[model samples]
Target: MTETRKTVWGVLSTANIAVNQVIPALQKSERLVVGAIASRDEDRATAVARRLGIARAYGDYDALLDDPEIDIVYNPLPNHLHVPWTLRALEAGKHVLCEKPLALSAAEATTLIETSKRTGKNVREAFMIRDHPQWLRARELVQGGALGEVRAIHVSFCYDNRDPANVRNQLDIGGGALFDIGCYAVAVGRFIFACEPERVVAEVDRDPDFGTDRLTSAIMVFPGGRRLVFTCATQLVRSQDVQIIGTTGRVSIAVPFNQSPDREARLLMDDGTVLKGGDPAVETFGPVDQYLLQAEAFSELCVSGSVDPYGLQDAVRNMSVIDALWSSEETRGWADVRQD
Candidate 1:
């Protein structure tokens, strides 16, 4: 019998997502291990490493990238630092699983694509929802025509966060409802629609104090006249819901994003048979950690030297849609989405 070697991952920062969600999930994977962690503040990094059982802690990010023992680097840093650091990690000869919205703009994201090609290292934007079973099943239903002639998707995601010191509230570093949560809407729409939108129009409300977008609503028109309507907010009651509407039926995701790993996830399918308050057919998925699934998938790519189906190009496309939305907000009219 041969012993399989696990891929070692070094984390770039003790970001909350990395420490509280991603690192814990990576630790649960059989094929991946958290080798080290780094933060500008050495004490904070050391404390996190101690708490998380990570073997090494570096005071600076470049030091961790310099370590040869690390097979991959998981970057959960803030939005502005995403591209620069991910590029550095690739230049240092390590694959990177970067946090979502890979860059502040489509132009910025192209650098990661270029660097990844130059370095022969795989880099993936960490949109964990793409790996969850429920989302997969949802995509399956869409492809299989479960909801006949699917024409539209409606999404509502919101949460209230007003802390002046919080990173999400900061303006200069890509902090806004659109970049924070609205990008999920764009990604999932592309995933389910299986194509990019033709044009988008948006309305935004910026916070008076923080200067970040607190609320955003956008409509995307896809090929075949299909549409996606979504709203995301950083200063509203917490909620999330997604509905796929079709000519003959509807599919509603009960917990679309931020699904609990310990509870069963569900979907409701309506065929229009019960018009008077009857129950829709329910599809349930057992508890599973999406973050763990995402880590393991990225690890496989790390070992195989293969490209992710939703790799840099897909991220660029997603960012392009977001860019169009921002453009629409500025122009107060429909803006064409850049496909390339």
Candidate 2:
């Protein structure tokens, strides 16, 4: 599509993830410009806007969403609030690219899909890792059937933080390991399989003090006898990796999820590494930020009005699997996923 002008983005929150990560990356995209920033506190909004060199600051989220000039809304709110704010933004005549796990449940995700349809605006889940070059290569490797039929996939992401004031620790505000880092694990399995899981068996360790899950592990069985085992944690040493085993061979990704473009990503193969006694086959990505790539992609979709290949439907599907996982934790057995 032809670009007439850059897409103007207005952020819905002063969340640290926005201030530190997404907004900075969005600014780097030539196709994107930070139009405004908002917070519930006027002074806080002004301070963040000045610090980030944003054009406008609003004391409330409604002001940013109501800006007629803002072409896109970048929402980085807490998990439970994602759908509500995204609906508000779409109703205000703006496209949306909300943060991951777009909604708390499959029901909420379906609601988001219908709302976006009614509003005639495109809304997407902000899974930046999907657009990264390294991940693209991994997808090609897996979907290409390098090792024949995929038998199992193992993915893990972890971090250690005990901040009491952080929203991640607040159960009432959608605080939990599964909703936070575990979303990445679930997304990875879904992406690699190129299909949804059929059933899930999960177990979670909830924090007694915070009343939120602190660690979670799940096994999802997809069609054709494929299984995915994943684990995520909030109180563990920082770590991330994904390994896929197939009937023919195996694929390993050293830096699978939370990655920096500046770093080198290794896609290891058993045949090349074990017998050859050589280093893992490596693919280095551009210093290009994944967030910038996602932003530019969203801008293209906004300008072209093309169908988003993995927007609401994918969000809803992923959330449905998540719902099964959560349910499995309670049932202490397999919970079936609803493909219908």
Candidate 3:
């Protein structure tokens, strides 16, 4: 007997992320089927659905959410809309795989988590870097003491998104360099360091025309004196890299920061040894594959009743760090990360 496919997914936006990444990933995953695409504009929805070969198209998000056949919902909506639509999806009896920064603030993230628990549904943030094999290997190596007690982590993610009308330039819709790119740096720091920072200090740069931050630099100090210094920007030449230093040696992840990085990451030891590897074929890298992995993982949770690896708790914690960073900038002093 042939094994049955595991999941059917609905996409809630016609955002570029869906068109470029998530749709292709769903098409590639053996465990998932692309069910439908939804956009606020009927014509755009139909066009994206037809172009992507998705079977169903909905003119509105709720119509797609109401479809019982859609087992998982991929939400790549704007940052401000994440909590509202994710909650709506859960209430509609659909599991949600929302893009990162989970919400504009930690309080919003907490509300979503509480609602997920109340509804007994799976809700996860889409932090695709965690699913990458190289990062997985890095985590294993670090956890196993290959680097001899991690002392510090340095990461940077930057790109030029200076378009006046780009969503990242819009303040009210939750557009800012910190929310867009800083979340990745923060997530990576927390993931590798194995704890959220006790305090955050940050500086932000705002463009005159946009009235939103275009660049940010932050320092996170974790317990045991480990430090993660990170920078994110929307007005710089593209660069993405991470370095972890320990007592015995160091590991460098070349271009580890991008939505799609083509170079193999490098690992170096104090003994003059170097290790190099490329992206895993088992997963797709960049915005699209990341969303797909999130979809597949949520499907597995629904089918098997397993704990979500990147669950609501993780989302809340990440948002809390973000909130603290913003607070640090506001007061020009270290802000303690608030936890609930």
TM-score of 3: 0.91
Could you tell which candidate, 1 or 3, scores higher by TM-score? Answer: 1
Give the Cα lDDT of each candidate. Answer: 0.92, 0.86, 0.82
Task: Give me the overall lDDT of model 3.
Answer: 0.82
Write the residue-wise lDDT of candidate 2 on 1-340 in tens digits.
Answer: 2377888999988998899889999888878799999999989999999999998999999988888789999999998899999999989989999998798889988887677888889989999999887788878877898778778999898888789788889998888889998888888888888888899999999988998889999998988888989899888999998888888878888777666756665677774456676665555555668888899898898899899987899898889998998899889999999896
The lDDT ranking, best first, is: 1, 2, 3
lDDT of 1 by residue, 1-340 (tens): 0126888999999999999988998898888889999999999999999999999999999999999988889999999999999999999999999998899999999978777888888888899999998999999999998889999999999999999998899999999899999999999899999999999999999999999999999999999999999999999999999999988889999879999888999989998875787789999999999999998898887787666898899989999999999899889999999977
Query: What is the Cα-based TM-score of model 1?
Result: 0.98
Model 2: residues with Cα > 4 Å off, grouped in runs: 272-278
| Candidate 3 off by > 4 Å | 1-4, 259-291
Instruction: Give the winner by lDDT.
Output: 1
The better candidate by lDDT, 1 or 3, is 1
Using all chains and alpha carbons, the TM-scores for the candidates as numbered come to 0.98, 0.96, 0.91
